[model samples]
Target: MGDNNSAQYVGIDEVPSPRAVGINKVSLLPLVFLIFYEVSGGPFGVEDSVKAAGPLLALLGFLVFPFIWSVPEALITAEMGTMFPENGGYVVWVSSALGPYWGFQQGWMKWLSGVIDNALYPVLFLDYLKSGIPDLADGFPRIAAVLVLTAVLTYMNYRGMTIVGWVAVLLGVFSILPFVVMGLVSIPKLEPSRWMVVDLHDVDWNLYLNTLFWNLNYWDSISTLAGEVHNPKKTLPKALLYALIMVVLGYFLPLLAGTGAVPLQRDLWSDGYFSDIAKILGGVWLRWWVQAAAAMSNMGMFVAEMSSDSFQLLGMAERGMLPEFFAKRSRYGTPLVGILFSASGVLLLSWMSFQEIVAAENFLYCFGMILEFIAFIQLRMKHPAASRPYKIPLGTAGSILMCIPPTALICVVLALSSFKVFVVSMIAVIIGLVLQPCLKHIEKKRYMKFSTSSDLPDIDHITNEGTLLG
Candidate 1:
């Protein structure tokens, strides 16, 4: 942490209100789909859960893991998101409970995880299509395709959040519809015993846990966009409710249909296996549709994630945790600088393999979440009387209890990381540690402007004297 005495507090008068930015606010339906795309994207990438752990454990993981992990994270998000209701999202939550120094670290780790998570999409998009466009399997065509895809989707994000939300709605329908048809048709062929088949001794625990965690995680990502949603206090919670049900069904139903309809060949299960399952159950036409839907789903996830990450940078800048340039917005009311920064990071890291990306991201994500959980319990204890438009129905001890299981899961994820991933993620963490002080030094030298937004609600008042601000 930085020197608490040296920390500069910017009064509210110096910054502009978020409403004055002229961006279109997201409504309930769009927000739900955005969260959908952010969190699951209709099970497009959940095939590995079945592959690693078998149909039974994969299905059971989807069934039971959400209650342990997703629900708790989403609940905390709904409560804290509304209480702060700014672009900074979880960063604001951590800052209020901890300090500006830790808040910046949370933002850095989450933003990196988000970008690493996003790099998988363009590659996945191509993976779904490579069978048809054989040239894209490798060579200049594949690299160029990833770059072009990133640019096009980045532009969609640059256009605005409302557009991104509606696009998610459309992409979501197209993506899930084929699976719906597959499930319907497969009902006649699904073997009841297939869902119960599992070999515990043979399970690839690492892959199984990673796939389950990756798909169900990111529910809190939407919190970063709280300022972009319409009537965030009410809309945010309702959207999380609707999105949670949609995301779980999106995974469980497809896993049930695919595993049961087809013969059990665990070796055949990998990324893009769902389309093959569609082919067997519904024929070539269904396979093609599933592939197209999977591709579109990747695109949806890319835009949704890019939005979260870019807005997070903007939120940090607004809170005086980042340089003023990151706070700049375009005429469309989107964060131009932050978008460029996030998009650039996506391109730079796009070459990493899918599993590598997943492992690296999960590691960073676990770190950020540890901070978030601690911040959640701390805020509840330290500010019991603070304004909370959508408080979690839990007392201080209850909140801490709610966080325990997920916190344990986080430790499991961290412990499972490979040495390469552990090293890379630690390097990223060190950069955040050093960067914060460098930024503070820059601020002290008068090289940049930074200020807290007047329009933001004070979730807790943390002063230099280590007391809550009035």
Candidate 2:
């Protein structure tokens, strides 16, 4: 932390208010779709979705998950958030009810999951770029594109959130277009008979696990950014619901609508091609729109990823889990050190193990879901009377029931991720475990032995007046 003891609180006349500083509604809503839809799209989405079951079975799973799983889980999130509105979204809230160990675990998983999963964005982007420009499919150009995109995003986020939100909103708009074209044009082209004649080899249990785990992953990210939101409780819950509906449409409709437009074979072969369905309907000119959409979709993810990264860094630093330097924030409130750490990792990851990195994203995703399940159960039971604008109707039993499908789904995915990715994930977790104890020991030593010098400059003093102000 900062030298708070050396610098008096300028606003000690006013205590920190939990209400206004909570989360703004505007940022929260769009973010929900941004995080969710990315996981549910493209060749990847289709692969996970159709591998074990086909469109018919995929649809069945989606239908079963929402009422049976999503609704109750969302409700649990609503209650936990409202009860601990003062905490900086999930990290603080989870920390409060479950203790710092679990809290650190949540934050760690969220950060790593985000950084690891983001490896796919550039790879997928390269795939989309190459799909159109066939020669660029393999060499330096492909690697260059990944480096450029990631660097620029890291820069954009380093500048701060205004840029992040602008990018997110535009991305949200851009990302949806291809899906729109794909669904609107594609749906009409489907023949019901095709559904019956579907091929069976797509049924890979591992692929389905990877696919669906991502389909519904990390939506709680918006809640984490709630500290920046305007009307968090009201805006958060409503925005979350809106994001869900929009995401479901953004994802499901494309597949549904595309059934009519592209041949099943064509759809299966392309990377992130719901936008391509528009070209099928509107002609070659639609490619521009789809490309624009792909760029925008990636932008949405970059914003959330960057935001989550900085926050995780700051939170860890503030709690003394990380070095003080990593927590340092720039004038724009960007976590300069933390942001660099993430960006560097992104840069390094772009070069090494990009393929395994892509698959491993699902592994980190599973770990997050498990934590959310734990948080959901614990917070609901601990803070029974907590004022919540929304509540999952199912008391403890119902919430537990809702958690099961997702929990089981995630567990299976953890196993299903390639032996390489699964092993890497285990290694990463073990590294974290090793560091956890060292961090605790270090913090304990500091708490017992370290102290700042008394000669530090004070921040509360008036500049021209040369007087300390209350």
Give the top-scoring candidate (TM-score): 1
Off by over 4 Å in 1: 1-21, 461-470
* lDDT tens readout by residue for model 1, 1-470: 00111122222222446544666799999999999999989877788887898999999999999999999999988877876777889998898889999999999999999999999999789888886678988999999999999999999999999899999999999998998999999999989898899899999888889999999999999998788888787788889999999999999999989988889998888888888888899899998999999899999999999999999999999899998888888888899999999999999998888899999999999999999999889877776555566777778888989999999998898888899999999999999999999999999998998777676656444222233332
Error of 2 at 193 (Å): 2.2
Clashing pairs in 1: 461-468, 461-469
Model 1, CA-based lDDT: 0.87
Model 2 over residues 352-438: C-alpha lDDT tens digits?
A: 443466567768756766777887787566544434445655677877887887777666667667777878887877777677677
Off by over 4 Å in 2: 1-48, 67-73, 86-88, 197-202, 273-276, 352-355, 387-389, 447-470
Q: How much is the lDDT of residue 341 in candidate 1?
A: 93
CA-only RMSD, every prediction: 5.4, 8.7
Compare the candidates by lDDT and give the number of the best one: 1
lDDT of each: 0.87, 0.59
TM-score of each: 0.94, 0.81
